[model samples]
Target chain A: MSEEIIIAGFGGQGVLSMGKILAYSGIMQDQEVSWMPSYGPEMRGGTANVTVILSDERISSPYLKVYDTAIILNQQSMDKFENTVKPDGILLYDPNGITHHPTRKDIKIYQIEGAKLAAEMDNKKIFNMIVLGAFLKIKPIVKLENVIKGLKKSLSERYHHLIPLNKEAIDTGMKHLKKFNIEKHIIHN
Target chain B: MAELKLMKGNEALAEAAIRAGVDAYFGYPITPQSEVIEYLMAERPEKRTGMVVLQAESEVAAINMVYGAASTGKKVMTSSSSPGISLKQEGISYMAGAELPAVIVNVVRGGPGLGTIQPSQADYFQSVKGGGHGDYKLYVLAPASVQEMSDFVADAFDIAFKYRTPVLILSDGLIGQMMEKVVLRDQVERITDEDLIKTHGSWATTGKTNRNRNIVTSLDLQSEKMEARVHRLQKKYKQMELEDLRYEKIDCDDAEYLIVAYGSSARISQKAVEIARKKGIKVGLLRPLTLFPFPKKQLFELADQVKGILSVELNSGQMVEDVQLSVEHKVPVEHFGRTGGIIHTPEEVLDALEQKIITHGHFRNHKTRESSIL
Candidate 1:
């Protein structure tokens, strides 16, 4: 099964890095993966996003207007991408930033206090890790251990000390995940 | 032998450039194509093979520097997106006029002017019909995937050096953005100054030489000589029609209808062909991977058996003209597509085929519509 995902947030919020981590995890798992960023000017300020496509077979195109999953870090990102989520897709958002809720009942919505959880872990920047953990809980496309390995491999020696805090943030976010899955057609057995 | 690795389009191009024995790379950073420069900058193959990579001030300077490097009989190339490719047209025309061998890659973006950073095939006419002044042709190759993107760079250089002309890789945003598994080629033999028709000498502004002053200038005021020069170019182009034409034909032998498309558009067209066959429509796809030589002969041969032709593209009927030219008055060549950064889906092409059947019967006086286009 192929899973196409979009991760969007403000610049330096690690939205791009989050997508990269997911893609790297897919590659490590031996799945065909592609990561494409917003073409040009869309990368500047308002919102920065990346599309990660993980598939068992060859992927024809990287451009997507409708994605199977979207992880939004801010209200603005949720506002921009909410309409584009495919039917029965998952919408994971940071409850600390987005006050408004999803209007679509068809989409499985997971709202986590990502910023607050990261602050409790003594690192607010680990908010991205919170979102990643939520994705792992909802999709379970890759193993949690694989993601941890990917993160450790990607982190530089200079910042190796932050790995434990980041790991705690992921665990906290996963613990708070409230699955709103309404689709019984999914064959998880 | 190298294993297939999932690589981005630009990264593939960089690996291909090295395998193609590229001696120099001159380019400026642009969207969709920036990864190419980044890859080359990081790889630093120049230290091992005497290669040189320079980030130029602009696309114009880059192409001119390429022109200079090519004149030295070195394998040189530059890559850019639509806007930058437009700026390099002047230098490209000069390189072509002087019969210099150089490879230029344009990772196309939407535009008549600063259109957008998105993927586009709007530059079809510009790349094939000559974007610069005067009459000229760039040997244009369109690859649909990252694997092809990696494979075509070496082929582009080989064709350029063999034909003594500028070769263009007319890649779109899809090819630039996508990632695929590509088997990287090992180190290959390099071409030196002595391998070319003419190298740096008194004519190339190279310090000194003993032979008659070779003139590399494109300005030939003498009409007869200029005419003769053009004829020679025409003859070479004609010869290329014999050796350089390339296309991928799938299930065309017994098919009654043919779809003509290229680049990423053709990839979807391939799936459409499969869909049509399952429905018993007897449809096949003729993908002209090389846009300039166009594989006109294949279209002409299929025209005799096929009922009609459908030309698909990312623009409004640009490549349709080429199919029409090939089919002549033998069959109808209908156009289908959406332009301006929008990609036409496979379902849309299937709809176009059904529409073709609805409007015109098997042949439906195909002669008349054919004449209007050809």
Candidate 2:
């Protein structure tokens, strides 16, 4: 199975690192994966994005025009990637800064209150891990154990002490995710 | 067995250089390729394998430093982007003329003149056709994947030392920035001064002890001597062409059309080939791993099999000229490209293949028929 995912948010929101963790998790699971980030000025403080592909076989292109799933954080990313998700795909977003809620009927839309939960947890940096947890809850592409191992590999040794707290944040995000169901249209007589 | 690690192409190149027993790295930081030096500095190759990693003041100084180190028969390397590489052309030419071995990595970004800090194959002509003003050729290796980016450092050094000439790793921002799995080699010891004296004692500038002083210079004022030097370079180039014509052909057995590309463009074209094949189009991809010693013979044979050849690149058609030269009018050769760092999608390439190559075949055949009649 192959999964093409786009993770996007503000530069400091850990969007690129989240994708890296996911890619590392895929590797730990013995899957072929690629992580491509949009580098340059946009990555300094503006909107940032990364395309991560996990496949059982070789990945052909690191760049993609569309994605099977889009995990968006900020309003800018939400506006840009809401429609780019494939039909019958998944769109997971943090409800903190998104102004316009996704209204697509052909795809599944879910919201994780990552910012609020991270604020409660007293560490805003774990916001991405929360969103990642929500994503895994819905998709389950890689196991949680593999994600923990990936986290250890991605984070430096000094940050190893925070893995438990990050793990707690993910669990909270998974518990707090709310699905937004598209209303079915009624046929006129 | 060595462990697999997820790394960017630039990072992999740096790690591989250290593991491959590179004696020194002198490079200036440039976008899309700064990671090469950054990794080297962080790893402290000085402590790891007694390899020296220094960040030069500029690209010019970095390449000149490479020349100095390579003159001593040390395995030296430097990396830069397109604009930065342009600054090193003179030094590269000097090294080529002096017959000094070195590895230069150009993690190419878009350009003619500081175009953009994005992935581009625009440097194809500049790289393969010799950017510097001299009758010289560099062994250019085009790596399509992160694994190749790591592997080709050793290969480039091998060829560089074997022929006592400079070799270039022509990569792009796409590979440099993108992360993928790579199997890194185990650490090898850097060549000691004793080893250098033993291997290249005759020509290397190693203290000039017990032998005639070996002066290294590109300046031969005498026309006849300079011409002989040029002939010697030409002979070495011809030998390289025969020995290092490397390419990979995918799904070309019954292909009606073929797409030729290298580096990152090849990776994208591979996808385009798959997309076209899924739609019942007999399309194939030919990726040149070596750009300078291009796989001309293989392309000539494929020209007879395919109805048309399309050269796809991120530039406004640089390598297409080489493709056309190789085909030699045996088939129609067309170019489809995106300039200024804009990457084309697989669907766009497939559309170009169907429109510019397949559907226009009748017109090309008609033109050929008219030309034959004339």
Candidate 3:
């Protein structure tokens, strides 16, 4: 199976790291994976994005204009990538600071209030892990054990103590994701 | 045993250089490629293999350091982006003149001047056409993947020492920054001083030990001597073209149209080929591994099989000239590019192929988007 995904949000939201962890999970399963981040000025406290591809066969490109899934974390990203998802593809987002919801009828849409959940959990940093967990719940492309291993690999040794908390956040994310009916979407000219 | 790990192209290349018995790396850090030096500095290859990693004051100083280290027959290398590479041109020319064996990496960024720190293939002409002024050619390797980025370190060093000329690993910021799974090779021990003296004693500047000094310089005052030196350099280049040319062909057996690309562009074009074939369009990709030896002969042969050829690059259109020259206009050759760090998508490449090659801009229904672009 080949899954091309784009994870996008404001720079500090761990958008890039979520993609990295996903890519690492793919590697743990011996699948070919590529993680390409947008490393321009936009990454500095502005909108940041990374294109992650997990494939059974050799991956052809790391940079893609369209994706099988778009994991959006902010209004800017939701506004931009909602249309880039392939028809019948998945659009997962966190409705924390988002104003405009996804408006595509051809693609499946889901929401996880990552920021609010992280605040309730009293650990703001696990917001991305929560979003990642939500994504895995829908796709299950990678096993949980592998995702844990990937999280360990992505984080430094000093932060290993936080894995359990991250794991909890991930579980919460999986439990809390809500899907949109996606009926009668308004078309923008 | 080969160990597999996910790594950025620049990091993988640096790790591979350490494993491949590199003696020293002298470089100045630049965006997109700074990780090469950063990884090397952090790994402390000196502790592991007695290799030296130094950050020079400037790009010029770094390249000169490479020239100095290589003159002593050491496995040496340096890396930089477009502007920094431009600053090192003089030193690169000096290395070429002295016939030094060293590996240089250009993780290219957009530029005529300090343009942008974004990935670009604009350096294609600068790399293959002798960026440094002189009668010399660097055996250029254009790596398309992180695996190749790791693997080509040893390959470039091999070509550098085998031919007694400098070799360049021509990469771009995209490949440099992208991370992927790469199988790391087992570490090879560095060449001992005794082995170094014995192997390169004939031409190296290892000091006058019980004999005449082995002088290393590119200077020959006599006109005929200079002519001979240039001819010898040319002969080496010819040998490289004959012996070590590298390329890859995908889905070309039944392809009606071909896309010629290298490095990261090849990866994108490969996807485009897959999409085109899925749509029942007979398309293929030709990826040139060695830019200097260039798959001209192979491209010429493919011209006979394919009805059209599209040269895809991240530049305004440098390699397109070479593509045209390769096929001698046997088939229609056109260029599609996205400069200033913009990468074209797979669909965009296919659309360009359709508009520019398949139809050849003849009998099209509308203005062809060229007017809109203009």
Candidate 4:
């Protein structure tokens, strides 16, 4: 199985790191993975995106045309990648600053109020993890234990204290997301 | 068990050099490849293994530093992007003439001048055809994956020493910036011997311990002596062509059409091949690992079986000429590419194959290797 995902948002929205954590989790689970970020001028003040691919087989073409899942954060990303999602694919987004919502009828759309939830939890950095938690709840490609291991691997030793907080944020995100019940899922993750 | 880390290609190249017991690294920072020096500074390989990592004032200084260090038989290296690499061309020629062993890395970006910082394969001709002013062929390795970016460090050094010639790791911004899971090799012990008499004793000027003093010079006043030196270099390149030519063939057994590409273009073409095969087009991909000792004979042999070949590149069209030369117009060859920093998609590559090779082949003359666009 292979999953090609694109995570897009403004410069400081944890767009790249979310893909990094996902790549690490895939590695921890013995899956082949690649994470390619948009390193052009768009990364400065404009919208930034990273393409993450996790496959049981060796992955090719890190620069993808479309995505199996698009984890969009801001309005710019929602406007950019809303229609680029594969038909019957998943489009997970945070409806914090998004004025225009995704209206694709074929793909599944899920919302995680990451900014609101982060404000509620009193930590703005956990916004990415909350959105990640919502995606994982719908499609549990990686386990929570391995995500903790992935967090330990990605973050330095000083940030180890905050892993539990991120874990709590992820649990809150999974609980906050109303359970997706589409029954016949075409794509597994 | 293997030691693995998820690292960007530039960081992986730096880490692999440190783990390979590289003696010193002297490089100026450049876009799309600054991580090579940045990672070495942050990791402090000096404390770990006494390796010296210095930031040179200029690209010229960095390459000349490599020349000086390599004369003493030290495993030294430098890295930069397209423009910076152009500045080091004179020094690279000197190293080639002196028959030194230094691994130089060119993480290419789009360039006719100080072009975009985005990834590109435009340097294919510049590198393989000898960017420096000389009749020398630099040993070139084009890696498609970040794992190969980590692995090719040791491989380049080994080949450099084995041939007593400089090797070039022909990577682009894509392979340099992309992050992926890389399995690193164990740390190799650094060379402690100052003289290095056992390995580089014949030519290295290590304090001139014995015999006649070792002389390191590319300049020979006598015309015959210079001719002999050139012949020696040419012989070595020929030997490399016979012994170490590296390439990969995918799905070519029953292929009706062939796609030839290298480096990042090869990775994109692999996906295109998969998609085309699913659409019932029997297409295959031939990826050249060593761009200098190109897959001429391999491609020529494959030409007898396939109807047409499409050379895919990130540039406008450079490697296509080599593809034509390799096959000698046995089958129809076409060039399809995207220039500047724009990368081609898989579907676009497949479409180009159908249009340029299949549909257009019947209307055009097969003898013309020079593309019409040029």
Quick one: best lDDT, which candidate? 3
Q: Estimate each model's TM-score.
A: 0.83, 0.96, 0.96, 0.95
Q: By descending TM-score, how would the candidates be arranged?
A: 2, 3, 4, 1
The 10-residue segment of model 3 chain A with minimum total lDDT is A180-189
What number of backbone clashes does candidate 2 have, counting pairs of residues 3 or more apart or in separate chains?
0
Q: Could you report the DockQ of all the candidates, in the order they appear?
A: 0.28, 0.74, 0.78, 0.75
Chain A TM-score, cand. 3: 0.94
The digit string of per-residue lDDT tens for model 2 on B1-374 reads 69699999999999999999999999999998999988999999888899999998899999999999888888999999999999999999999999999999999888889889989988988899888999898999999999999999999998998788999999999999999999998887888777776765567787766778888889999999999999999999999989877899989999999999898888888888888888899998999999989988999999999999999999888888999889887888899988787888777888898898899976986787688679
lDDT of 4 by residue, B1-374 (tens): 46999999999999999999999999999999999999999999999999999999999999999999999888999999999999999999999999999999999999889999999999988899888988788999999999999999999998898888999999999999999999999999888555356765577766756579778888989999999999999999999999988999999999999999998889899999999999899999999999999999999999999989999999988999999999987788899988888888887898999999888775654335455434
TM (chain A), candidate 4: 0.92
Residue B257 CA displacement from its true place in model 4, Å: 1.0
lDDT of 3 at A119: 90
> What fraction of the reference interface contacts is present in each model, in order?
0.31, 0.64, 0.82, 0.73
Model 3 per-residue lDDT tens digits across residues B289-342:
999999899999998998889999999899999998999767778899899988
Better of 2 and 3 by lDDT: 3
lDDT of 4 by residue, A1-189 (tens): 899999999988899999999999999999999999999788999999999999999887888788899998999888889888999999988778877777777888787888899999999999889988988987888889989999999999999999999899889889777422334322222
- Off-target runs (Cα >4 Å) in candidate 4 are A178-189, B192-196, B365-374
lDDT of 1 by residue, A105-130 (tens): 78877766777777777777888988
